[model samples]
Target: MLKKLINIVVFVPLGVLLIILSVANRQTVTLALNPFEPSDSLLSVSAPFFVFLFLAVILGLVLGAAATWFTQAKYRRRARSEASEAVKWHREAEKQRSQAEKLATQASLPAPQG
Candidate 1:
């Protein structure tokens, strides 16, 4: 239910905005690749303004996500180790519990006479 609401509120608006941008920015513009010579037409490419806008946005998002992942690498490693430690402790506890139950049952039974 929340997902639907989010789609309606966030995604729908964003999609409409992108569509409008694309339509409004349909004009072709030259993009220079080299920094040394900005006027070099041979090293430039022509594309729609919307294409550059979307590409820059996507590139920024990818770089930002990659930086975030790298920054949190230590946290991710710590969480993974903690998870394994928790599992080990849980198994050890279960084993001890079973052993205790077995001993309890044995103590409850009557001894056999020779």
Candidate 2:
């Protein structure tokens, strides 16, 4: 419930602002890919300015997420190693417990008659 409220508070205004910006900047702009020929229509893309703005924002988010994932790789490796170690220790403990129970049962039995 608290997460929903936070999302509503943060995203509602951001969505409204982006909508207003797109509405206000309805002009078509040309982006030229070839630096040698500035007027080449074959190497250019023409679209609304807001489209480019939104594309840049999306690209930045993707790059930031990728960087964070790469930086935390060491911690993920350590966690996997620790989990395997814990499993090994637990198996060893169970084996020892069963052996101890078997010895206790043997000691409780009566001696054989001569």
Candidate 1, residues 44-81, lDDT tens digits: the string is 99999999999999999999999999999999999999
TM-score of 2: 0.88
**Candidate 1 local lDDT, residue 73:** 100
RMSD of each: 2.1, 1.5
Provide the lDDT at 41 for model 2: 95
Q: Model 1 clash pairs?
A: none
Give the per-residue lDDT digits (tens) of candidate 2, residues 1-114.
999999999999999999999998789999999999979999999999999999999999999999999999999999999999999999999999999999999999998889
Q: Pick the candidate with the highest TM-score.
A: 2
The lowest-lDDT stretch of 10 consecutive residues in candidate 1 is 4-13
lDDT of 1 at 79: 99
